[model samples]
Target: MAARRKANRILAAVLVPLTLLTLAGMAMLWPSGSKDGISLANPYSAAPGVTFDTGKIQSVVEESCMQGSTAPGQSPDTGGQPAPAGSDCMFAFTEPDQGGSPVKVVVNPEVAQSHGVKPGDQIRYLNLSNAPGAAASQGSPAYIFVDFVRTLPIVILALLYALVVIAVARWRGLRALLGLVGAYFVLAGFMLPGLVEGKPPLLLALVGSTVIMIGVLYFAHGFSARTSTALLGTMFGLAITALLAAWATDAANLAGVGSHDATTLINTSANISISGVILCGLIISGLGVLNDVTITQSSAVWELYELAPGTSARKLFTSAMRIGRDHIASTVYTIAFAYAGAALPILIIVMLYDRPLGDTLTSAELSEEVIRTLVGSIGLVLAIPVTTLIAVLVVKATGVRTAGQSAVGVPDEDRRPHGTSGAGAINADDVDDTGALAAAAFERRSRQSTEGSADPATTRRGRRADRG
Candidate 1:
């Protein structure tokens, strides 16, 4: 019991100050929300006398490419070129959501050639019917396809995911989901804006991620020595990941080159550093996996100790690490495969280049993912043993008997042999603890009448009967 209190005090001393510092960092680095540096044009903003509207596809017709027809995302000044032999122009006849005549919407060439929409598909389009040039052209295009409406499908999947998680894990699962929402809130509210405002990327990521982990671990798992140990482990892993990412980003020259989005950000915002953004992304990407391994390892240690309280600390540590090893193996593959899946398109493109393996992996286009997998893997792998050790120490201090009595709360004599009596005799306190209750039950059975058991051999046989 004393040892448990000591551990709690130590954890409190460390975590409380860290939390305060993180809060201070967040306050200091909060974004001013000034849009002075962002010069990107908003394409979706409608012009005077024109509106963006949604519609259902009534039919699609193939025709020769028209020089004046506008395509989705195409600039108005540079119109479509003459149609190639195999690439005929396609247009969708859509019934607008607002009561009106069916409009002919020109589909973008990429979409028309790839996954063209059929009848009954809902899509958003630009309505240029009332624009200034509507009456000037011989046959002015009135509508242009924007993108598909995906709200219904996305919402359905989200609800189904929530139901399954809640049904399987109950209250804990619900808390986990809520914690996820809060984590995103922090990301969107604090970290993203801070980055845009040119805050120190490494510090912003570390502080923001730490704050997220603190909230997520405590809210989802509750306050306990076990949770505290896991949180500490998570912090260590996060720090390691940040440092590795910082070094890797610099050494590999990952300046977000060869990416269209990165180029766009560079062109639009002079304050935002593409490399810093990548650094932040590399660190943030590993948080989920890092937290998973730390918490799981911590829980594994506690459970192993509880199931066998008499096991030596060395044995306990060994057993817990066995579980950690399996986790490490599986989680490494998980990180690698997850990154691979997300970057599959890039992978296919790279493969077609027919470059050497070394050059291919080290290229700016692919090195970021390779480094991400390695850095995240290293951080999480190190955290497992650290979490296991902490959990083992804590569980030994609080969960098991120290000398002859319960370390949790019970008295010494309560654990004495079945028929013994002392100051620690079974009482209401015994009922409060599971281990104490089992001992008390055995004591009561021993005190019961010994009728029909005169022969010692016969009583021994009766005891062994259940073993068979």
Candidate 2:
């Protein structure tokens, strides 16, 4: 325990100062405004500039579906006329953002289910100087469908999610959400700008991720031995993840520029390394789940110790490993299934190919997913045991409870069956003589730390003193 405290003091003294310095440096170094603007790599035009305006639909002129050689019931060659009843619609709207002058636009009927715009609905649109028709170019204005201002639904959904989280997990959930906001700010404000300015993606991601993990672990769970243990494990996992991702990217010859967005980024900015950015993404992607599993494992070990405080460190380790095993079983599938779900469309397309299953899996896109999944899973799986081992050592070090409370992640309602809650409910045999076991374990650890066993007479004297 003394040794542990000394170590913590040293770490805090070093890390706290270092972190502050890093933040100060970041604030000074990061560019605020660039002439080019922020983008994936560089700004590439996905959509041409169109005049954006707001309006409310005043009258529903015509709503119909187009079919046959002509659109709806019109000919494009002779300037489109009114379409069928099932085709798109032409509407007159009051331009509130533009001096309230009434204007007209055509809304595609196909997007009705998705957009749900109707007469009297307020929306924003893009007014084109030259639409398809010569009439628009000549004199009339044409508006393109943009978006409905649905802030209420978005606000409601956000509130629902927040309520659900707070109701179930209470304070912890709130803190976790705060941590998420901090993570977002760091990624958006610091990491992204640095990446855009052509800083080393891997290094920036690594440092930013570390800062995020530190804040998230401590903020969400509070500063304690258990959180510290999990954090150490998380850092080690991140290092392993970064290294593996680097190796895999190189070995697999993954350029990470196959996607349309990546291709656009490459064309837009020739400076950014798509592959390096992908490697950085790979490192960042595993961080959340990696933190998740490590924290869980650390908490499980602490819970095991609290349940059977007298149990030997080895026994506690094995017990925690049992829980770790179950978590691993569920989580490995989580990573695999998550990637599979994301790539479902590609998987379906691949299935239509004339290739065998092995060949299909070995394709560029699919293989990238596989390698990413494997790398993340490897780091995650390894983190559990490391975290568990660390937790056991810390929790058992002085035979004293650090928090004097249940594990952080395991809620009070979940520690045992319903209507049962003390420290925990476990077989008495599992605990044995907790006092004796603690003393024995402490004695053994003390000898290991000092590199020598205590005298037999001193041990007997200590026990007698305790009895007295």
Candidate 3:
């Protein structure tokens, strides 16, 4: 008990101060509401007499790629050059939701060739019918496809995911979902704004991630030695991941130059550092997987100790690590496959290039994902044993009891059934009353069978009858 108290005190000493410091950092680094430094062009910001409207596709048709059909952000052909034979474009006839005549909208060529729209699909379009030059040009374009409306399907999937989680895990799952919301709140409210203000990326990620874990762990799992142990393990893993990510981002030169979005950010804002963003991403990407392994390892240790209360600390750790080994194997694959799936398009593009494996992997396009998987796997793999050891020590300190005695090194008397003087009885006191009763009954039956098997008169009678 005293040892457990000491462990708790140590955890508090570490966590409480860290949390206070993180909060202070957040307060100091909070962003101002001004957007003075941002100068990115907005594509969807409509000019006078132009509107962005939603509509449902009435029908789609493939027509010749001619001079008049212009896509969004495309200018009308003024060279008077005829389109090549066999070239075509997709045009969707759509009815506006705001009560207007059906208009023919030209779909973007990339969208049309990749994922063409059909009738009854909701879409957003830029309506330039009332613009100044609309009446001057011949066959001037009116509506152009901007994007597909995807709100309904996304909302449906989200609801289904929530229902399944809550249905299976009940109130705990609900609390976890709520904690996820809180985590996002911190990410959006504190961390993102801080990044926008050009705060230190490494410190921003670490503080934000730690605050998230602390909130989610206690809020979802509640306050206990087990949870605290898991929290400590998670923090340790976070620190390792952060340090490695910072080094890898610099050493590997993950400048995010290969990504279009990254390039846009470079052209858009001077304050944002692509390398720093990549560094922050590398750290944040591993948080969920790290937390999973650590908490699971901690729980496995405690459960092992509960099942075999007399087990030595070393044995308990060994048993727990057996589970941890399996978790580590699966979690590594999980991180690898998850990143692979997200980067599948990039992989396909690189594969088509038919480049050497090493070259492809080390390329700017693929290097970040590769490094992310490796770094996350390393952090989580190291956390497993640490969590297992901490849990073993804590469980050993708070030893289980039976009849006012520690279950570890239990007395012989306590190992036997009450009101009986028989050998071969297992330790009934190690388990609850119901299990103890079942053990005693089984022992009694075994003793009776042994006595019957040793009856000399009965054996002789059976042998004589068989001979006759």
Candidate number achieving the greatest TM-score relative to the actual structure: 3
Q: How close is candidate 3 to the true structure, as a TM-score?
A: 0.84
- Residue pairs in steric clash, candidate 3? none
In every candidate, how many clashes are there? 0, 6, 0
Please identify which of the two predictions, 2 or 3, would achieve the higher TM-score against the true structure. Answer: 3
Best-fitting candidate, scored by lDDT = 1
Question: Any runs in candidate 3 off by more than 4 Å, and if so which?
Answer: 1-10, 67-84, 400-404, 407-468
Candidate 1 lDDT tens digits, 276-363? 9999999999999999999999888776555434455776787678779999999999999999999999999999999999999998
Residue 404's C-alpha lDDT in candidate 2? 41
TM-score of each: 0.83, 0.70, 0.84
lDDT of 3 at 122: 99
Collision pairs in model 1: none
How good is model 1 by TM-score?
A: 0.83
TM-score-based ranking, best first?
3, 1, 2
* Model 1 per-residue lDDT at 21: 93
